[model samples]
Target: MRSKTLGKIVLSLISVVSLGLGAAGPAAADSAPTAGAPVAGKTEAAGKGGPEGIIGGETADSSRGMAALHRNGNFLCSGSIVDNRWVLTARHCLYPEGERIPDSQLTVRVKSLNRTSGGGVVAVSDSRVRTEHDIAMLKLDRSANAEPVRLATANPKVGATTYVFGWGRTCATCAPSTVLKRATMRVESIDADDVYGGRAIRTSGLNGRTCHGDSGGPLFKLVDGQRYQVGVVSGGNAGCPDDSGFRFASTPTSLTWIQNVMADF
Candidate 1:
């Protein structure tokens, strides 16, 4: 089993390169490309390394309220804006199983395709973790002003199409992507468990799969041209880009908790 600590260690190492690049300052926001739209059958070769990014994926054309999480200026994980003041992500991104992470050490960049720049960075004022589920919610210090994604009230059925987004590595040893990337996948098992053994949604890569740095990223299901977040990237097996073994905590399993947390904010 991929332990929760394994996920943290992988992400920590990935952050080294990110910290160096971030020190140089944010790059100019690249013009919105027409390619951000979801492609039906796009794929890329996986790079050799441990795990990271969407192996065999394409650059995301739209941010769709995605947020790049950073810890002490180093890229950490990915998240989604669920409200003007709330960002939802994996609990492991915040800290270990039982520990608490200080709100001051975390920040989220929202409304941008580029993680290093081109988005508003907001400090976290408060956070809540659903320990049993491996999911967490961060309360932004102020409104993000970015659009929020709707949380699904139920899990997608097996074989349902889904999409995942992140700024993780493209290859095993590659640095994390500066631009957001996404992959097409199919729900493989709604009965799976996350790294922490929380109820999770397992997916098989159709054209791409979630890897390192993708922790806490959103797994979205499209309905009526609308995007509903059905899962949060938790962890996966080591063989990324292999078209199997991606797992995300099922959002519907903890919808009531999410609502209560949001209501308190």
Candidate 2:
């Protein structure tokens, strides 16, 4: 059963204390990364690697918040392969703001994700979730079959590096639209004490963070030969300049929750 209330909060969330929080990390991290993949993160939204890059440096000090979005005019979000057929994402992405959408109205694509370019496509079969927990699982018609990202079994750690990917607005404190976007962000920390503590990464020199189209994106880390998905793009403070990056956070990683959900499969 869902343990918390999952709803959309379009409010701008900054890292200041007394804000909100979301359990950015999830069940998948307990495993490992995709096989023979880069040890660094390639967290992006739409297709395979959405709009993110390796965490070479940091970005501005701001952020944005959003739900599900598109990539190259295709329906997709930052998702990760969990188990043989389930792809995990934020509850809001599957059910934006926790609002449910008819299953028929939802689909997924994991092909070539390019904003400047474009590439492959995969169709999701079904979806399941724990709304209160801010988590959802997308059932793919076929398994990734290739090197797929896994989740962490480790406990949520403070100062741990968290990655984020999405197609939201490119600026913090700016207007957001439902367009395909992508970027690699960092997790300054996972502040569970805050209202929606999904503290994610910020750009190093940019004045913005995850925007509107970024919701339901992937958050991962490198392990072994693959990328291990740990969180989904949630929300954050938007509206910033190119010099002051923005904020973006994900859900926390929980072990029991992941095992329980995947056991059914």
**Best candidate according to TM-score:** 1
Worst 10 residues of 1 by lDDT: 33-42
Cα lDDT tens digits for candidate 1, 1-265: 3233334212221232334434111111112111011100112232344322456666677776688888777777778888889989887777632345688978888877777777678888999988667789999899988878888999999999888888776765565667787888888899877756678888887777666567778888887867788888877655343667677888999889999999976
Task: Go through the candidates in order and give the clash count of each.
Answer: 4, 82
Worst 10 residues of 2 by lDDT: 32-41
- Model 2 has an lDDT value of 0.37
RMSD versus native structure for model 2:
10.9
Off by over 4 Å in 1: 1-18, 23-53, 96-99, 239-241
TM-score attained by model 2: 0.56
lDDT of 2 by residue, 118-196 (tens): 2223445566765344466766567544334556655335444444444333343222222233334334455421113
Query: How does residue 187 of candidate 2 score in lDDT?
Result: 40
